[model samples]
Target: MKSAHQRFAGRYRPPSPKRSPLITPEGAAALKKELENLWRNQRPVITQAVSEAAALGDRSENAEYIYGKKMLREIDSRILYLQRRLDLIKVVDGLPADPNKVYFGAWVTLIDDDDNERHYRIVGADELNPSAGCISIDSPLALALIGKQLDDRVELNDLDRGYDIIAINYVNATST
Candidate 1:
């Protein structure tokens, strides 16, 4: 007969890929703000709720206690992750030596073959938001744009697409 532990062995999972440690100053600040809110505001409220629920006894059957404990665990996990990531991340601030060339935190404007203009800000993975036109520096498109100057043509062989760099700026602006 197979033992319970042997019968229900955990599934093997591959480790996640390593993310770049680079972040924009804004991104770092946002992360710090989130950590602060979780630690100083949310956690205490949840802790107090859990304490009150525990005082009612019969914790095993108390829904409030169970839910509160789960929330606390989730908050703690996020706090730990933020702390570790913050420790290793490098915040990129200020303009690059050549503001005309694409670099981390640069807002790049590209014109496709169809004459459609697209704007994107190259930022760290933590700050990527497609709707906001922010792309990760480690992304393929950002990789192709890095070190490229205005009016330069970029070809992505893998995607079979090409774009022309219309503008590159260190500041956030819509117009070229």
Candidate 2:
């Protein structure tokens, strides 16, 4: 007889590819700070509120109590996730040996086909903030940019546009 998964092949979906476990030092630090804040600062306040709400009695009808409990569960879940991720991720602190090529944690400047300039920092998946121009290393754009040199053209297979690497720096220019 076929296995259960084989019988339900149509309904079963394969797991997504695992994300890169590498994280920039700044990203690691930010995760740490967030975990600390949620655990020590936010959790306590919410706990206190929950306690106060509970003392009011009739928790089944208490909105404050319900909301506080939900917030506490969310905070705990995040704290657990952060702890696990922090333990699993490897923090990349220093610059790559070849500064001339694109690599993780590098702030790259690209000129697109339209002559529009775009800057993106290749970082870990956990720290990707598109609005801030921080792209995940596992992203298609970052994957294509990896190992590329200055002035090299990158033709994205999925996108209609191509980009030229105008600049690549390990340090964040805006930070200075």
Candidate 3:
């Protein structure tokens, strides 16, 4: 029953999400809102629905009961996950005072040698998504970018794909 991902360890646990020790005022508020919304709004709604469905009887044939219970379990699981995550969390919502240097939460625009441009927001692992223009702080590119100034150049390499040296053109807070 072990999937390939789990074959090595019986399950895959993504590394713990990375976050800066401090949060921007905005990031902090958002995380708080998220925790509240999940625990308060979502948790109770799912719980009540599951209880009502369970009362309908014929448990084996009850689609509503099955689905509702599953949903409830997911909600409770996420609530527990968030509780643990938040306890370990350090939100970095504020931009570093030195806008010239790349730091956690910096939005950077890079010009690759091939003349292609890419925009990235360096963020904590929990907040990073390629489609959202965010990258994890611990990623190779972000690691190289950190503490670098605007106009600095850096390279990223993969054994199979060669490497890229991009010049940093801009650095700012992505919040705006």
How well does model 3 score by local distance difference test?
0.70
TM-score of each: 0.89, 0.88, 0.74
Per-residue accuracy of model 3 over 1-176 as CA lDDT, tens digit each: 97776677745578966555443345556667887997889878877877888888888899888887888778778778767766776766444677678887777778776677787877666565799777878788888888888667777665222223343323344434
Reference-based TM-score, model 1: 0.89
Encode model 1's per-residue lDDT on 105-145: one tens digit a residue. Answer: 99888999989999999999999999999999888999999
Off by over 4 Å in 1: 1-11, 174-176
The RMSD of every model to the true structure, in order and in angstroms, is: 2.5, 4.0, 4.7
Candidate 2 yields a Cα-based lDDT of 0.94
The reply for model 2, stretches above 4 Å from the true place, is: 1-16
| lDDT for each candidate structure | 0.92, 0.94, 0.70
* Model 2 clashes, total count: 0
Better of 1 and 2 by lDDT: 2
Ranking by TM-score: 1, 2, 3
Candidate 2: residue 172 Cα off by (Å): 2.1
